[model samples]
Target: MIQVLEVKTEKDIKEFIDFPFKIYKGDKNWVPPLKNDEKKMFSPHTNPELEFCDTQFWLAKDNGKTVGRIITMINHKYNEKVNKAYARFFKFESINVEGGEQLLLFAENWAREKRSTHIHGPLGFSNLDNQGLLIEGFEYLPSIASTYNKVFYKDIFDKLEYQKENDWIEFILYPEDCIDERILKLNETIKKRYNLIVNSFKKRKELQPFIPQVLEVLNQAFAELPYVIPFDEKTGSYYIEKYFSLLNPNLIKIITNKDGEAVAFIVGLPSLSRAMQKANGKLSPWGIYNIFRAINHPKVVDLALTAVLPQLQRQGVAAVLITELQKELIRYGVKEVETTGIFETNTQAVQTWKNFKHIQHKRRRCYVKEL
Candidate 1:
């Protein structure tokens, strides 16, 4: 018989974090998240979002062996904003379809007890957190910001009658093929015509002050998107501490208008997928060394995040940012670029990728079932 247990003790939490490593063994395309980071995300003292979200973690076991794990969450803040009682399940994994079904049933019952009308996931505390199930591109190596799973996991969702709620597509671009001479020239013209100034950084200190404005632009730009909660000061500061150090200063581009206010920004990181794989989810001495080595010499760059002020959307700001960043990528001898998930319905963002020599190699989805 399969049994489900709520994760409450330190040992249980460790099992929850370690379950993926067991399932993805020998999977070259899977990247392990830092174990320390995973712990921090679940701690109330560390992750501010926990203050407003009710969450629980579970493990499914059969004959004393772990078979599956899942997390159920209800973000009260988000529920208030949208005025809907929607629950979410995330980091779901299982050894087989039966284990997966038991986990989902547990989550569905938990949601119903909480008075939620529907439950959807592979979502996290916020958009910045990894979300979506990899419905396609199982062979492609996932960026550190993306999620990966066994192909059979989709079968579990299908059997549970979960309907697709949304899909996000990822692309791979060759920097050389993506750069257009006309776009480069047009970037300059756009800068002059709009009195926009492009800022490139050589050091983190040079980029520090503008961080707040970048978050503002991100909040404004993504306000209308489903499941996006505006970043409060505490949440923004938490992310800055977590990810700012991994960024390559030279790959960051910020655009400002005549008033010197940040209107748009793009942040890219040297791909750490291989380094994280080497680390095996621990930041050991050797793991830290591998990460630094990757940072200094990267063959692939991940476009982690980009945002423009809502009023400035479609004014060629995105193109200018991309052009500037691409030039730097070439200078750094970068060979390939990987993009974070872009919603399939986001036509404006999708159109920007068309100018590049690219392929829609990966697709992830969020699934929902009405209670």
Candidate 2:
């Protein structure tokens, strides 16, 4: 006996947010997301995605115990531009194959009523949220804020005939050992010749102005990117506030051209795997302390986002940033650098990693089915 409940009320939503606790009761690697963050991301009153999108969440139950959950989302702004009523699903978890199928069927019919052409999953409310399904590296514990799922999740999707549409590749780097002498000299020469200054944010207050500048450049540089919806002012601020707290000084490199304008940026944070595992994504009286501690002295560093201005893309400036960062990474005794997920088709970005012997350590895929 399986049933899926649409999370519409406060209680239902709370259950939806807490389902993972019950589902992964004994799983050691699973980390709980903070209840407050989950609330904000799903609630129209809090999530900025509500400005241009709509989403619904469901929790699956059998015999009065939670078994699975899923979030169905539709970005009006994206569907219109992409020329299809494409739907996305996220926060998916399950203990049974039949239950997962039933939940997905509900979403399929819902999208059909809206005349959607395709359905994709495990993506969050928008690109700003988590996107992609774990297709490889299930044995490795994921970084904080990075996604993890049971290996069987892939088998279920395969059983559904969903077409693989996109792949996001993550890399693990041995920066200390891979820095070539030629590349090192080239990095120094480029920095001096171009008069580009790499700014390292020392104090929390110092990052305030650059927050908007980085976001502005990110929005501008990645405007034409696929599946990226433009961020409103509020959402932009929220992103900065959430990230700067865990930043390591050398992790952020603000690339300023000779004119002193921020032309490029890369943002990385100390991994909270241990802390997130402890806090379970909650910032409550008990959890907040653990999360704060994890960020201050993190073992794994997750490179969440990176971008270089389009005008300078042809000149190979991103390599310069990486080369310098790699040296600092060695001095810092960093274990391994996690490259942000890059679209498999992004050859130029891939090439930058090749110079440093970066391995495609993880593969997350997006699957679609025509409704």
Best by the TM-score measure: 1
Tens digits of per-residue lDDT for model 1, 14-67: 999999999888889999998988888778899998998999889999998999
Off by over 4 Å in 1: 177-179
Over 4 Å off in model 2, which ranges?
177-181, 192-194, 284-286
What lDDT does candidate 1 reach at residue 94? Answer: 95
> Relative to the unseen true structure, what is the C-alpha lDDT of residue 284 in candidate 1, on a scale of 0 to 100?
91
Deviation (Å) of 22 in candidate 2 = 1.9
Every candidate's lDDT: 0.91, 0.75
Q: TM-score, each model?
A: 0.98, 0.92
Per-model tally of clashing residue pairs = 0, 4
